[model samples]
Target: MEGVAAHQKRKVMVVADPTRESAAALEYALSHAILETDTIILLHVENPNAWKNPIGSLFKWPSLPSSSKVASSPSSEGLGNGAASLGYAGGGGGGEMEFLEALKRACEIAQPKSSVQTERVAIMDGKDKAPIILSHCATLGIDLLIVGQKRTLSNAILGHKRSGSLRGLDTAEYLIENSKCTCVGVQRKGQNAGYILNTKTQKNFWLLA
Candidate 1:
C-alpha cells in the first residue's frame, strides 16, 4: 500500500478566479485534503473575448511565454510581486495580475501550515473555460478537482424567480458533469469571511466582514 501510494501521488487542481469562493476552496484543500506529497495547481482562465474587445484591457493572448517567471520588483505593477515569488508567468492586464496575486496569496497563506508543492497557471484561450479545465485535468492526471461557488446578486435573484432552485455556474457545472476525477465544490460560508493576499504589501486582508 505504501508503494502504491508512492506511485500514485495525488495531484490536485483548484480552479480559482478573483473571488472569495475560490479562496475558500483553496483554504479547505490546504486544511483537510492536501498531503505533504500532493501537488496542487491553482488555475485561472482568462476570457478570450477580453483580447478581442478594443476596450477590454483585462489580458492579451500569448502576452507572455507559456511559462515565464514573474518579474520581481516592488513597483513592477500588476501581480509581479506575489506571482514572481510563486513563479507565475507575467505580461497580463490589471485583472489578470489581480487574479495571479489572489492565487499566489492563497497558496502563501496555506503553504506555511502545509508541506505541499503548489503552482499557479493562467490559460489564455478563446475556448470555453470548462473545456480548458477539463482538458487540463485529463492531461495532467489530476486526482482531485476543487472549485468554489459564490452566489452573485444576479444568481440570487434568478434563483428566487425560479422557486429556490439555482442553476450551477458554468465552470462548476461543467466539471461536475464531465470530469473523470473526483470534484469538490466549496461554498463560501459567511459575508466577508475570506482572506485576500496583497501582492504589494505581502500581507493578507479579510474580506467583507
Candidate 2:
C-alpha cells in the first residue's frame, strides 16, 4: 500500500456531449479517476448557437431518440435549414436529454454502485462557457472536472464539419487553464498508444492507460 491513495469521496464532473471526445473523457474518468465513494456529474454545456445556425456543427449519436431535436445519427445531413428542425424554439430543455442519458448509462455501467448526477447548462448569447462551468463547479463543490480533448488531425481533416459553432474544443482547454478544482483534459490515442492527457500541472502528458 506504499503508493496507494487514501480513500476519499469527491464530486467528479465530466462534460457530456455528442462527440467521441466527450465519450473518451468519460471512459477515461471511469477507468482512472472515479471511485465507489465519489459522485459523478455529467454536465452538458449547451451552445444555443448550434441550433440557431443551420450549418453549425452539433452532435448526432445513434443512441439519441429519433425525435430528438439534436442530431440522432452521426451525420449533419439531418440538420436541414431552420431552427425548427433543430428544436431551437424551446420544448423542455430536452434537447440533449437523450444524449445525456447515453452518458449516464455509460457511467452506470462503469460504476454500478456510484451515485450519479446530471445537468444541462445553456450558454447565453456569445458568452464563453468556461465561466459557466467554473460557476457550476463552485456551486456543486466539485473536486475534479474532466473535459475531452479533440484530436488535431481530426480537426484539420474534418475542418468545421466536426466543431462547427459549438467550439467545444476551446472550452476543454479553457477549463484546464481556469478550473478551480482539479481539471483534466483527455484525448484518446487509440488502443496501442493509450491516452494523451492535459492537466493544470502537465501539458500533453502521455499515459499508458
List TM-scores for all candidates, in order.
Answer: 0.53, 0.68
**Candidate 2 lDDT, tens digit per residue, 23-104?**
6787678777787778999989897767555332354422222232223334324444212233332222555335566567
* Prediction-by-prediction clash tally: 2, 0
Off-target runs (Cα >4 Å) in candidate 2 are 1-7, 52-97, 153-169
Q: How accurate is candidate 1 locally (lDDT)?
A: 0.52
TM-score quality measure for candidate 1: 0.53
What tens-digit string does per-residue lDDT give for candidate 1 at 1-209? 13446445678888865454665666556655566567777777666455544333332221111112223333333543333333333444444444456455535444433334444445565456777888888988898888865555533343212221224445664465567887765555453353332111121223332
Candidate 2 least-lDDT 10 residues: 61-70
Candidate 1: segments with Cα more than 4 A from true spot: 1-8, 51-102, 105-109, 112-126, 152-169, 191-209
Q: Between which residue pairs do clashes occur in model 2?
A: none
Cα TM-score of candidate 2: 0.68
